[model samples]
Target chain A: MESNRRKFLKVAGISALGIAGAKPVLNAFASEQEEEAQHADVEIRKNEKALTARQWAMVIDTRKLQSEEDLKPIIEACHKTHNVPDVMDTENAEYDEDNQRHVIKWIWEEEYKHAFPTKSTEFLDDRLKNLPFLVLCNHCENPPCVRVCPTKATFKREDGIVLMDFHRCIGCRFCMAACPYGSRSFNFRDPREFIKDEDRNPEFPTRMKGVVEKCNFCAERLAVGKQPACVEASNGAIAFGDLYDPESEVRQLLKSNYTIRRKQGLGTGPAIYYIV
Target chain B: MLELTVKGSKKYFGWMALVLGVIGIGFCVYVWQLISGLQITGMSRDVSWGFYIAQLTFLVGVAASAVMLVIPHYLHNYKAFGRITILGEFLAIASVTMCLLFVIVDLGQPMRLFNVILHPTPGSVLFWDMVVLNGYLFLNLIIGWNVLEAERNQVPPPGWVKPLIYLSVPWAVSIHTVTAFLYCGLPGRGYWLTAILAPRFLSSAFAAGPSLLVLLCLLIRKISKFDPGKEQIQSLAKIITYAIILNVFFFFCELFVVFYSQIPEHMDHFKYLFTGLHGHGVLVPWMWASLGLMIFSIIMLVIPSVRKNETTLAIACIAVFAGTWIDKGMGMISGGFVPNPLHHVNEYVPTVPELVITIGVYGIGVLILTALFKMAISIKEEVAA
Candidate 1:
């Protein structure tokens, strides 16, 4: 056993030397275009016609979502298209004093006061005071969840969308702690077991037990030149566009309205803005 | 040398058998958990981590406590610690083994654990924790085994081991620090975001680890012909006294900052822990009990007359151990999750199977410690004869 360990260490040491030897040679042959592209502030789109930017962002118009009924279609569309599991049985499941349960959710509604606990005040208008605000992953430019993942299971794409690679997740839940937004969910059991057969989207793959998952902002949809399921269903309530593009609807909306973000004081640079 | 464990007193064999029995049961329960998933545990979407992670956090301190002995014996040239230093290292080995086990059992995908190493993320604190913890375990194993071998042979330890021994000291500090970073560096959890978390962890670990060691030393003296010596025990008590005092002071410093600021994000967690926040206070009793024990232990330890008596000292050390165990293991992790991202207080209670698994892991740690100490003590007895 000792000799085997020694042999492994020797091989590892030689590999380290090989990598160190190859690094400078690899760097020396870098193309001028590639170097200039690396320095470019804007992302060079694969297809110039596609709505691509260095950072993709979302702007939610909570005013348009006047009632709980207004949110159902958007949420249902996202959940159905993404094959998100419906494990929560709120009526039947035993709940503690905190009303917590073993559940999976990619997006949901929360009271404005609770959703913006640090920012909201008690003396707001009665309609706004009792408003049910939509909440989901902020897709922060500096996502803490991505930073804390041991397996690099969750990572931020160059377009600023946080992506979850379900296969790589070890289900350690470190990202759960790191994400202040509480956007991530772990599949405690086989999610497929909880999902209804008719509701399941055969087009999308379901996750297995023991992996953390969260909203990917429908990066797959964006790849295929389709709007996010929620955005398509919101009927102008939600605007999905590039934050880096001056002509984008989201950028225009942000310019015209005062928008707030969840825990912006932490300097995570959250991409999801709320037009409260 | 491996056979040394086989020949033991009937009581020793009985104890080993009992621990093995519990481990057998625990293994069965762990298999159930693996098949059914973490759904059986009380962990919810809000409180993602529960009892297992808490135990992992606490045992990391116990593992890092070997440095308490290593620092004095090697750096300060304290000769009295030479006899008990191996005991400390062996304890660390056992503690780390349990830490690793707790991590594995807590994972949703225990099979995918190597994905951590396979990916080798420098960005993640969990990755660093894996690195430092595995590194510390091996360091202690190599140092403890070689040093004991040299002692048994009645020769000086090999020259290479001296550097490794020195390396283990800072390496011990790194383990707890990385563990603290796992919580403190998170953006959302106001409770663990304090700058003092790493130092607080180290101080509390210094107190808790040495306290456990001193208790173990007393136990060894009672059970075996070898005595770790009164001087070594007393020195360890002194270390615990100063460390526990500093640990308590750091806790108050944290309290002051949170209360004075009056920020709900920061203050809400303390409110939940010390007092019920928004009518949820499941952990209040445990938190207060921890505080009471810590105060009582510090009072007893500070008074020389009380501390000098071995019986009183043992009781005080037990208090310190239990107090810090509840604080670091239960309150710290759970409190961070309460008043979760949505400003709701979620409570976590370990299920029966979860408790059994936890006890089983502790049994494994004890079994490992017993075997290592059995080997060491037999060698010491032979050397003395």
Candidate 2:
């Protein structure tokens, strides 16, 4: 990358000087450079499919989950351990009261409405309106969050989990806005305020104000062959397995059950599936 | 007559602008935000964009408003607009400059903005917004400068310049329409999902933007001895009246649709905007203020006796401009995100750094506007000679 950049700078400088001296020479050089850039893109594409890794995904069985009370503790433990700050008390509280303000650290989504107008529907009773599902970053085939981020702070890993580099983030929170699932959270205030001084999850870095922070599917833990904290804490109700490995536990579960994503209509093609 | 160029208009304006500059400087206290992250602003995860974007929306309207004069004078040959089109263009340049600055300030890493061009995402609305705004800015620069140069040189502008001038009439409309598209194109935000949003934005901008220009022209008349003519002023007031009525009518049409559909997803945004859904009521007063100002301004502008009366027209302009700014600028952006998709409220308030950055940008715009207007006045003085 450095050598290419250096070569580009040298080429640009030489071309600029050439343009000042001879316009025809500069035009020839520019066209040649453009052709080379196009060829490089084609070369990258030819080699892309050969690259492989353990494509990790999750399967949550919502039918096994009884109530918010049954799920809250496991959700809170991972959240508190991860230092995911609660966003309930901010100015947006006027729209909804505190505690009702949404904060996520690998948790369940009780009610989700699809983005497409035709797909959006309500039940006769408020309780029966929407099915509860586990919500987290989809690690999508084509992630909008990764695409919209100007800094490239949010990116997808080879393992299929979308990772966010917290330190490099300028904190414009465009990722939070782009995510259709409402899976991302912005650090409205320093997470350090809520974090216990001695206790911190080294696997999940506490975020600063202004930047977006979301579930990375515990990329740090995955590097060491450990499962995600939420998957481990779900009392085996959640299954974590390699999506590429047809023999993996998640694949077996998928084959046995009617699996669904939180919002399949959005076409995110989420890696995480749920057993209805 | 020579003294007019030598002496600046209202020696007090420099000081007044400077005071605004000083107050703007006070916004620096929030610079920790850029270092610490966006936590300094009263924004949370849910309400991702806040006051900065709202201000951008309003200012964009103000920026695009330059067309009202340019179109009438160049297209229809309204000589009444002959003297003041430069002022509108100058204001457009100033406001658009600020609009770009606001986008920068809103970025988490302002430095990484280059990556936008380096790795452009053609699919995203943001990428398109960048293209249109920068394109509009360059277009305005050429149009404004060429016209000014023509007036200065005492020549009918070059024939090639005519196409560019004609292109600007639609291009002016495109800038604000694209801005509206920035919101409307978002799939999830029910408030912006309506197809009417872009037209509504244009109508409100036409009303507020020209109203502001009319006020500025009156001020130029009072202090700078630059009378832009009463007929031109009254003509713009008539346009403002119609635009405001259209804007208000479109808003009601939206309200009617939201109620008629009875869709929870669609209704929630309107509920949050006007009635304060789930108890978020901060936007209620601002909405009322906007509605009240629009109605009052329309009444004042509709009556010829009042619209013709310079003082009444000035007040009407101020009311309409401020009202439209509140509705388009503040209420719309916040209302879209409040009670966010997850039913979460993340209220956005401008922090100190955000405010300072905002003020600094506004100051820079004002300085640019002042210089351009000063140059325009001198050129006019030279031409009349």
- DockQ, computed on Cα atoms, for candidate 1: 0.69
lDDT of 1 at A159: 89
List residue ranges in candidate 2 displaced over 4 A. A1-57, A63-134, A140-143, A150-170, A188-209, A219-226, A241-248, A251-260, A263-271, B1-13, B16-20, B23-27, B158-160, B345-357
lDDT of 2 by residue, A1-276 (tens): 965885698699879887797865567579879999899877443232232347778898876765675567667766866777655534565745433333434554555343223344554345324445457777877687777665567888877878887766665566676676777876655567656656666656677555677777766666566677787778888888888899899899988898867557556667888775
Residue clash pairs of candidate 1: none
- The local lDDT score (0 to 100) that residue B321 gets in candidate 2 is 90
Indicate which candidate wins on DockQ: 1
The best candidate by lDDT is 1
What is the Cα-based TM-score of model 2? 0.80
Angstrom error at residue B210, model 2: 0.2
Report the lDDT tens digits of candidate 2 across residue range B61-84.
888888888888999998888788
The residue-by-residue lDDT of candidate 1 on A19-96, one tens digit each, is 998775566456545778777977755643344568889999998999889998988898889888776633554543
